[model samples]
Target: MLLITCPECGARPETEFVCGGETHITRPGPFAEVPADVWAGYLFHQANPRGKLRERWRHQAGCGLWFNLVRDTVTHEITSVYRMGDPKPEIA
Candidate 1:
């Protein structure tokens, strides 16, 4: 089982967290004319990295706050966790 480190409530089981998808997507602004491809890319395209990945996750059963998680997909290891507004520190 994977252990997710909650930014507010310390380390907990992965079941307590909810995957919130990629972290760097920008919504189209009003009066902005974005191409269909651009919209599709934002909605569908994602990076399936093997090593450390930066993603958005919500602590559904704990603090109920959305936070950023830097985790390893291959080994199911969490490198670091932090809130959205806070700066991410370098993972040791």
Candidate 2:
């Protein structure tokens, strides 16, 4: 089982959090001016790399705060977790 640590609630089971998908995806400019293709890509596309990937998650059952994590997709290992506005933690 994946053990996810909620920054506010301390260590907890992964079941307590809900993943919000890849992190660091910047939304395109004003929606009214963005082209259809660009908008579609922005909404549906995400990088699905096999190695290290960044993701966002909400501590649904705990503090309900959103946070970020740097994880290894293949090994299901989370290298680091940090607050939403804080700089991402670097893996040593």
Model 2 agreement with the true structure over 1-92: per-residue lDDT tens digits: 89998888888999999999999888999888999999989888888999899999999988899999998999999989988888876654
Worst 10 residues of 1 by lDDT: 23-32
lDDT of each: 0.81, 0.89
Model 2 scores worst on lDDT over the 10 consecutive residues at 83-92
Runs off by more than 4 Å, candidate 1: 89-92
* Model 1 vs. true fold: TM: 0.84
Clash pairs, candidate 2, are none
* Candidate 1 displacement at residue 81 in angstroms: 0.8
Q: How much does candidate 2 score in TM-score?
A: 0.93
Each prediction's RMSD over C-alphas, in Å, is 2.1, 1.4
TM-score per candidate, chains pooled: 0.84, 0.93
Best by lDDT: 2
| Candidate 1 lDDT, 63-88, residue by residue in tens | 89899988888887777777897776
